[model samples]
Target: MPIDHLNPPTGAMADNVIGFARALRKAGLPIGPGAAIDALAALQLIEIGKRADVYATLEAIFVKRHEHALIFHQAFDLFFRAEEDWKQMLDSVPLPDDARRKPPPASRRVQEAMAQPLKGEEREAPQEQEIKLSVSDREVLQKKDFAQMSAAEIAEVTRAIATMRLPQAELRTRRTRPDRQGVRLDLRRTLRASLRTGGDIVDIRRLGLIDKPAPIVALLDISGSMSEYTRLFLHFLHAITDARKRVSVFLFGTRLTNVTRALRARDPDEALASCTASVEDWAGGTRISASLHNFNKLWGRRVLGQGAIVLLISDGLEREADSQLAFEMDRLHRSCRKLIWLNPLLRFDGFEPKAQGIKMMLPHVDEFRPVHNLTSIDGLIKALSAPTSGHHGPLIRPAA
Candidate 1:
């Protein structure tokens, strides 16, 4: 395990350690200056030649969560792999061939972190060469698939999603509220107020139907094919939950698990971690029919009340596709104000509802929209704000 091939750190080891910590922070890890200082002090107790010792020491000080381990490992490898000066090594490192195959999210972030010059160090100027104009980073990010985004890009997208506000279109309820311009006259209130004037009414009191935001019920799929998109969708759900009071979140894979309380945590990371711990199946096989049946039988009446808008996030690749799935989908559609099916598979330009599950559930949904990127998510917000009639009416079939 000893890295005897590499020399021991020089007087500048402290700076190198601090720079590496900063890189990890930029890559969405929670490492800070204190952790960096602790790492440097810990390095003195163990022989730096032992790569295992160095890795453990840094990991213990830097990594705070299970998900962060990948980012830390990739960053450490790229940062400390050089036998020569670390700064020079970073400068000489070539970018991965993104055109051929996209790097994993963690690896891409590690590469971006390594490309940055450390504190007190200056990046060498590029040789004078012909330059070409390119699209803006934000534009490119908006179009990029959630699964293809790097850790840093994901963090940026999460921030953007958090700031996104849903439209304030309220639904009318049977309850009434006091309003001067109301159509219904309040005789009781008018009579009570006229007591001071000895039955002489001064003003006419009126009441109007109370309005509240339509409740949102998200039924998210967590099967193997949907693992990547589900994580991002959960972040979106967290933001929605924080913004509104009547939001319910449920995760389904082999079974249905209600995660509304878990996702209510203020911190996105903590909320997601809590959800992971509570759900037995994170990236398991799909049993869409069974899960939908469970939801319709048990939770349908409870969460799908008061003009709820159900957001079904899934690929519709059900392992147990049957007549029951269609039955449950129809039941769910009737119970909610709107049943919007958000499918990540729709990102494919030539996508068709050929899958058994997709075909069965397609007719029940009020609208079908892609949920693979930020732009698609924005489109969903617009669709919810201004729902159209016959957007995807019956008789629409998948291409054969």
Candidate 2:
């Protein structure tokens, strides 16, 4: 039987759908009123009491991305449960161990959204309470690890990263452009000027070497352990990519995938979505050595020219031999003007170079830094802005 025949389009059911949509929107799904209306219409075409039918109906209308399916189901399970179940849960009634069924864990954003009062609902105002923040919320967020952040906090941080501007790490190129006080004399222009003056008087035109922002090539690890930090770092890279045209981004897990073009989109969310769709090995096993070898073999000379700076963002965990990793790291370091290693593992208080991969790759990087938080990113901008002239020696600054 159709849902309309059994569960008709009641006002209560409509309200429930709208409220559920609100909860999902809060949980980071891009749900709007139109989606809720569509979901309700879809529900009318299916049997409502059958959980699978209802879920499919709503999911077809609401869930657009593969990654959001988990959030949708978690919210669905919590919102569509029996009223008695909610009462039991809210009232702190404990079920007997024999009767209890443990559900899979939900993301923090979903839990927080479910706890909040639904929009446009009238409720009594709570009693006032005093709250003090010695350090501002933004300040605290700057130092918080990306792995430890809640979904809402990640959203906030992503926005902050999108607004960040990369300092122009200028490089003096051989290519010249017209400048008033340029040192190089333009003989052709000087000759043209002499002809205009009937060969009696000559004027000299000077050209200055173009000062362009150094190209940035980022190789980010997407292994399971580095996924959280990498996802956030990609937001930062997106910001830089949009600001500058020369930035190239690559994601590596079991292999290397160039996402330079993907991140060139003006919208950060759209760019990241494109990147996620293009990458097949996200949050998969690590093969640091193989990925680096692939990068060095194919993309080394192409993107590494014009004094490019290479940012290797990884935990330096390799499942293969360290010998190959060391060779590739050396090749990459030699190709780029500056090679900075941004390791999230450096955030640990007692981090040591015990891992063979870490030890082998350490000697090749000009700078070793933490990239687990916003403050570390700020430090990176400072480091990049500093002068890079006559600096050929290996400089390894330990994490603070």
Candidate 3:
């Protein structure tokens, strides 16, 4: 049955509800006609004049996931509230003028949704305007910082990241395979083959070294300072995990939680949702030293074998910067083939290893690279593919 057929809402109220549903759909919510019907049905039980009741009714019908809450809230505010009040609220600028002028992360998509015309609704003709086609917006978005992006931009970036392919650099192993031009000859095989030719040696089998992708162990910080970058890095990890089997992921804030299984989900959204549910210390305090110590003691030997590469993604802002931190860092470095530190803080031009934790950890990392934007991520990919010329050694300060 059509949604309008049930309960038969007054013309104005029904139109508003349908338009609101359309707006939500535009804003990336998965609201369908059934949800709209349900919302209308729900409204019948509650007083529509009560704002809280209306908000609850619509939210209960529309939202299905935790991350969708923010988008739903923004959409509700813009759709149900008076148009002039919303315009005024959005227009009001806060102090520190420049800081207040920027829109909240979800506001951009909410505004876009509001501007979309509902079906069968009379719309004013758009004013004539010149259309200038230029470079694709995606090219521009690649360089944008993850922290500054809106919800829609994040969705776009997530899709782009899911399609990104990691460079496969094979590591030599002790295992060997048969090859005609191998360095070592297989005498047994050669002798057995000679028997087939009536004691005449026609060919010799040789064995060569086997190569495979080194395991990738990621230790990502989920502390307050590193929250923005961690989420995006998780998306990257999910993509790589789906592509490669030997990848392991760990999340650390006040403690360490191995999220390898959680990230193994094929859907990025589902993977992140699982990660969020499993991790308890997200956006909490930083305890780099303790987390590293835990990893070195419990997980290092397991995942750091067979020329594994460790990607340490953090800002190196430790709440407990002590000798143990350095010791753990050294042990971790020694266990892995390469210890690359990916710090979003390195995006700054004048960044230095001034923080106590950074100074302690810098001596152990093979490479120190930024990871705040897509371009920086691309740089990391290139760095991983290229050969490393040993560890860079301890940090050396320049003379003033």
Report the lDDT tens digits of candidate 1 across residue range 1-400. 2333334344677778887888888777887767776777777777666665677778888988876766676787777764255444234333333212432444654686677777463533211110111234677778789999877678668778877777554677778889998999999999999998899999889999876678899999998889888898888888877768889999999989999999997656667878888899999998888988999999999988778889999999987788999999999988888888888888887887788989899989877888888998888777666632232334322221
Q: Put down candidate 3 lDDT per residue, 264-343, tens digits, no spaces.
A: 86546657878888989999999999999899989988898878889999999987899999999999999888888999
lDDT of 2 by residue, 1-400 (tens): 4433444355667667777888888777899877877777777776555665666678788889866766776676667553343333233433334223332323455676676554354311210110122235778988999999987678678768878887664677789987879999888787888898898555788898877788989999999999999988988888887668999999999989999988886545556778888999999998989888899999998999878889999988887855888999998988889999999988988889888888899999999999999999999988777766543546766675
Q: Which ten-residue region of model 2 has the weakest summed lDDT?
A: 123-132
Cα error, candidate 2, residue 173 (Å): 0.3
lDDT of each: 0.77, 0.78, 0.77
Q: Any runs in candidate 1 off by more than 4 Å, and if so which?
A: 1-135, 387-400
How much is the lDDT of residue 166 in candidate 2? Answer: 70
Q: Give the TM-score of candidate 3.
A: 0.67
The 10 consecutive residues of candidate 1 with the worst lDDT sum are: 125-134
Report the Cα lDDT for residue 48, model 1.
60
Q: What's the distance in Å from true for residue 95, model 3?
A: 46
Using lDDT, give the best candidate's number. Answer: 2
